[model samples]
Target: MVRSRLYKVTRGTLRLLSRPVRRAQGRGGIVLEPYRGYGSCDEIFLIGRVFRQSRPAPDADRDSLRDLWRDVGRRIARRAVRGAAVTARFGGTEQRVATDRDGYFRIHLKPRAMPDCADPWRAVGLTLDAEPPVEARAEVYVPPAHARFAVVSDIDDTVMHTGVANKLVMLWRLFVEDAESRTAFPGVATLYRALHDGADGEQNPMLYVSRAPWGLYDVLSEFFARHAIPAGPVLFLREWGLSWTHPLPRRAEDHKRILIGNMLALYRDLPFVLIGDSGQHDPEVYAEVVAAHPGRVRAVYIRNVSADAARIAEIERIAAGVTAAGASFVLAPDSVAMAEHAAGLGLIAHDAVATVRAEREAAPPEPATGPLPGVLRPTEVPPTVVIEPEGGRRL
Candidate 1:
């Protein structure tokens, strides 16, 4: 009877201790679950938990428990959260939402067809609610035009291609891949070089706007140096904040637009070039730029990376608008084509303008093309060799 009582006490004590762990598991599960959020928009939250066996002594298993907890924490802190897939539809197509720990994600919606007017934006959020229940739903609303573009650019598949790989996969490749393993599109360097070189007092200074995070600055710099490409002042969007436990609320495109607007305000009269790839929101962003700064944009050049029909149509519309404005809108299959188009615009030329120094210090004129005057010519042909032949005997 005494032994049986002891057994009950032990059982109660074990349950009491296990309760905290269980609660932590439940709360921690939700803490790290990935979800989507908007800065000034609706916030989507996800929750997650860590699971483990409850047989070992709590103190004895402290190390293992701590390690497991840490592992899970690291995963969550690193923004690795598994949840329902969410896709945003804009420009008649869909784009996926990328998630990170703290149950936060930045959903990139297709920009409204008419950014100037309020149009309904749409997105489908999918979630699996097991430990952290997965939920799926569609979100539709118009986002405020928080900023305007002075410039926008394409990221992957435009600047660099780890080929057929996703952004996360490409990031891994960047770390593991060899120097030669990476590739830059043809003429990209030259295009950037021309822009960096600026427009000979007629063109505005260049701004490099891309979706690549600032962390890749060193790697990108190395890439440029390796290719002998000219470097320009780069403006990168910080992916997330150090204090951010969740994904930052700003969309990559939105971030770029914000930056563009800031630049425009600083140099109100300066024009800008919108360089981007077809793989993403370049068309939409460039279109927005055209709309915002009708005459301020110099050109929009899109590097074709995908063959999406809808994207193509959007590009056509953007091109037409650009053409109407006397500016250029080009869609090229590769960087070579982009270069050729730029060259056609007289943006890139071979003729060097004669500078003041060159004109002032040109070599002295070459000897006269025609015969010189008698006074100027040597006096060798004396006055008709008057019988100077054999001397002797005065004639």
Candidate 2:
């Protein structure tokens, strides 16, 4: 009799907890239930608050906000289910399905139409019933074949430009900054889009390793959508708060290196491409990766966020290490420069090599006099002698 009474109490408690869990899972009237009907389609799970604290009357309260959320989710579902018609320009030329009675939606993309590379693609189009019609979007990038080419990217400056070293600033940038307020680096979207689109829509995969924690996934997803950047599975360092005191549970650089090493081991057969900015320890981290992986790294693209000569030199050294290991290394001022460099290095093909060469040869050049000045003479200099030291010591 005692055991049965205890079991009944436990059951009652579980039932009580389930209500909150279900509500927490989705109280906005649009809940995306997993495994119901999402099969072989690109699925995006949306979860967020639907409460307005500034409303005047009680009737114009949280429930009203919830209704708005449901309406927006449903509208987005309708558009996503009709895929190609909405995202044709962004390379979404396929059909999708919407959840029945639930707030779920699935986009059934053809294998070839899906982004095979790590670059982001316009995965979904959303419209919310706001004063100006709130537009919500989703970005997605499928993993590459063979699981090679892990993508190591910086979180703050490279992606969002939040002063990461400052905890308060980082928090404000992440929490308070809305989609309309954020700005992407010039040409960033184009470069990443090209990479995601790949050569003829087929290329290697990418892994995003960032210093931000998993809590930023939603915001990051929205950011990618706003910027038209591609999305990939992200590995983030744990943040401090409920579990610890420091913002990051471990040293950020060390955490990244450890995760990168583990990933290297996990995808031993594949090569990696490290992307970062000059603001932090990316140089050291990438150097370590190059040393450890040797030929396994395909390239390193370091964004020049700082004009510091020492920092630039360090990045060059890291790039040199990658180059020595039979991979390419590039330091670009912006995404356009990176794209040009990538094309030059054959990492991506802007056009057929023969076609480009032919075009170059056919193009006009400056008319020359019979003999140019000595200073104007074009001479071939050996690569080793290009960066000679003051005393003639080769760099």
Candidate 3:
């Protein structure tokens, strides 16, 4: 209770201090910034923001310290336009929306009949109601009916080498590093691509969920493109609160659980391959998901990043419940093991295993970041023993 009061006071003070500076700045015409949206055939969900001025693009060659700092400043110096009127047009339907105080608008459109197209992404035309009306195009991904199974993966530790357990290190990676400097886990790009391009030559749906705030959306998008990881339809990210005491997300478990549940409901017929790491509460949250929606999950792949004996033991217990609920729970030390298991299940091509292994072996070593205790590198740990619900088995 005391901490809550302190947080409120601190946030209010910061808002008061910034208001005059924000007002002093000159405002420009309305600009619509739309994020990638996704949904099934029956319904579509999309979200975007309205800003007074267009977003500033960073330098193409963002290598120097000056360029890096300038890029960060441009990305973070946002001026949102409140109560802006906008219209969304798609499927011969038009809907009007008003931006909230934060300049964010959400559209839920249930088209009478979706336009027939082979492409997974359908464009939604957006128009801002202003003196000189501004127009932009946004896209929503509707998985084709032929898509076999969908993949839902976490972004932080599962896909990349983010020191999420250490707040200072995580902040450094998130704010200071540019997209080109950020690194993905070895073989992650190949593994995700294989998952996207399934065994039977089908294009499966890939969705990413992260606890990172929406402020880092552009950086994350660039990172995925640079790494050649199959792009997800939507990036489920949380809003960063202004309180200094609670800079990071407070309830990571509930945030992830709700988003995963929403995805399950969106793709009613499609089963999912859930992927995350053991560094945080992923195992516990995924256990609840498996228990809540049995038979909907095909497999759960947890990258083993924690070296604590107690943490591994707890994860093993969670894996037991997950397997009992009828999904394969794989605690893998490296991406190669995950690829091999996926190939055996026919989730991906058997030949993709060799590709992943080769990439893992050829990838450059991680940059030195001094001594980080309690965090185990993949090369430092032996293969994790897979514990079956009824009986344990070695991977």
Best-performing candidate as measured by lDDT: 3
lDDT of 2 by residue, 68-180 (tens): 44333332232111111111112354333433221223343443344443433334444333343333444444344533244556656675556554456455455445444
Off by over 4 Å in 3: 1-29, 54-77, 241-253, 369-379, 387-391
Query: What TM-score does each of the candidates earn?
Result: 0.45, 0.53, 0.84
Q: Residue 58 error for model 3, in Å?
A: 14
lDDT (C-alpha, whole model) for all candidates: 0.45, 0.47, 0.77
Best by TM-score: 3
Off by over 4 Å in 2: 1-150, 165-168, 242-253, 351-395
lDDT of 1: 0.45
Quote model 2's TM-score.
Answer: 0.53
**Candidate 1 lDDT over residue span 226-319, tens digit each:** 8666443455554433223544334443576666665555555456667776666666766766677677776677766555556666666556
Candidate 1, RMSD to the unseen true structure: 25.8
Give stretches of model 1 more than 4 Å off. 1-155, 162-169, 178-180, 198-204, 241-253, 350-395
